[model samples]
Target chain A: GIQVEQSPPDLILQEGANSTLRCNFSDSVNNLQWFHQNPWGQLINLFYIPSGTKQNGRLSATTVATERYSLLYISSSQTTDSGVYFCAVDTQEGGAQKLVFGQGTRLTINP
Target chain B: GAGVSQSPRYKVAKRGQDVALRCDPISGHVSLFWYQQALGQGPEFLTYFQNEAQLDKSGLPSDRFFAERPEGSVSTLKIQRTQQEDSAVYLCASSLGGRGRRETQYFGPGTRLLVL
Candidate 1:
């Protein structure tokens, strides 16, 4: 079983500030995803980057598979971004393709 | 196209009672999965189904937990003799591809179960 760890378990920033969240996995992974769990508990998919970099609006993610780590960056954060950000990876054990999620980073933005 | 949808967004069960949760994955999705997320913790895999065949269920905590997908579109997860520890948010996810493919999984609004 692979272990996923998210850094800065808690983060707070001004509406116009920027932040970065990191996820480190103990083993190699075949798929990686980032999600934002809103206050209503919906897991909104943010990115599906197993490697390289991708940008979606104010959110961007980069996964360095060789280093077994990934980074999520939020630029000019908005108050609506307040919620839990999760980093999940698939080790593809026995071809099951189940995702293993990190403890998550709780982000708060002040308006 | 609609995403995955779950029924009875919340449930309350007493100890020793049996509870069933339903998951309606996106139409034509070949893979479905179930996960459990405890308070303040990340979701953990419970079971997985590739079409009508359940290929992996090693993540199930115990024999009391059961999951099935008879027709390969909709699935159900049942817990027999639920205990207090069974309280958690049950999530259902579906992917467009079968095993070994790198596909994005879309999750439904999870069903929050509280066992008293």
Candidate 2:
């Protein structure tokens, strides 16, 4: 099984600030995704970057497959961004697409 | 078009009772999956279905758990003889394609189960 570890387990910052979250995997992965779990517990898809970089609005993500790690960047964060951000990966063993998720980074932005 | 939808947003069952949670995935999606998330922890895979066939259930915690996607579009996760340890948020996700594809999984709101 592959291990996924996220850094800065807990983060708090003032609104309009920027932040970065990192995820490190123990092995190679075929699929990687980022999600934001809101206060109501809905897992909102942020990005699906198995490799390379992508940006959407104030959120962006970059995955270095060879390095076995990924980064999520949030610029000009707002108070509504307070929640847990998760990084998940799929190893596709035996053609199975089960996701192994990291413990998540709890982010809090104060207005 | 809609994302994954789940039923009984919250549930409470006494020990030894049985409960069933339902998930309706996005239309035309071929891959459905079930996961369990404990308090303050990441979600763990439980089972996966490619159409009506269940390919893998290795992540199921015990024999008391069962899942089925008979029609290939909807899925149900059933837990029998529940214990206190079974309390957690059960999440359902679906992707557009089958195994080996790089499709993004869309998740439902999840059903929170509390076993007393």
Candidate 3:
């Protein structure tokens, strides 16, 4: 019951440009977050990593997690960062906190 | 109410009627979740509570969907006769448990149901 794959489902950047979004998971994880469903949907919570690097200004994230993959970096982007950018996981490693989302990465910031 | 606050943000039933969605966590939260978003995907576990017990509803998809959190804060998700695929958008998360199983949930700003 663990499968999450999000990768450039759709993206269009311009304002300041700089993007790299990806998240892949299939197993081994107690939790892993990184959401931002703005545009009035408000599910914001940028990074919980669940493994490695993390930054919260220019927006950065990196979770190797033994190759499970996870990388989100939006450098100088603006335009409110557009919308949808989620990558959740909770492979039940620790149980209780079920989450397994990943059909996002629809960012469009053209200003 | 710093976060996790959901309510009648939007609801328009008709199919079979009987709907009740509400959640307000984030005040000494002790685990509380219920998600089901279906417009572009993402957000799908249907239930789980620790305070008022409700272990997990196993994603609840049938039985007309139902959830409650009695005296463990505030939570309710009842979708009786409703149909039309139950529409979409209906999230409500909360964490900060005893700091064990895992933390950081906090999500709310959803509840856009439309079954007609």
Candidates' chain B TM-scores in the order shown: 0.98, 0.98, 0.32
**DockQ, computed on Cα atoms, for candidate 3:** 0.24
| Model 2 misplaced stretches (Cα beyond 4 Å) | none
Higher TM-score: candidate 2 or 3?
Answer: 2
Model 3 CA deviation exceeding 4 Å by range: A1-14, A17-29, A35-49, A53-60, A63-72, A78-80, A84-91, A94-97, A100-110, B1-12, B18-34, B37-44, B47-63, B66-79, B83-112
Clashing pairs in 1: none
In model 2, the Cα lDDT at residue B94 comes to 96
Tens-digit lDDT string for candidate 3 (B1-116): 78889889999999988999999999988889899999988889988988888887989999889899989889999999899998999999999873247767989998999999
Q: Which residue pairs in candidate 2 have backbone atoms (N, alpha carbon, C) closer than 3 angstroms, thus clashing?
A: none
> Highest lDDT, which number?
2
Individual DockQ of the candidates? 0.79, 0.81, 0.24
- Is model 2 an incorrect, acceptable, medium or high docking prediction? high
Tens digit per residue, CA lDDT, model 1, A10-85: 9999999999999999999999999999998899999999999999999999999999999999999999999999
Position B94, candidate 1: lDDT:
98
Error (Å) of candidate 1 at residue B102 is 1.2
With candidate 2 superimposed using the best TM-score fit, by how many Å does residue A91's alpha carbon deviate from the native? 0.9
- Ten-residue region with minimum lDDT total, candidate 1 chain B: B1-10
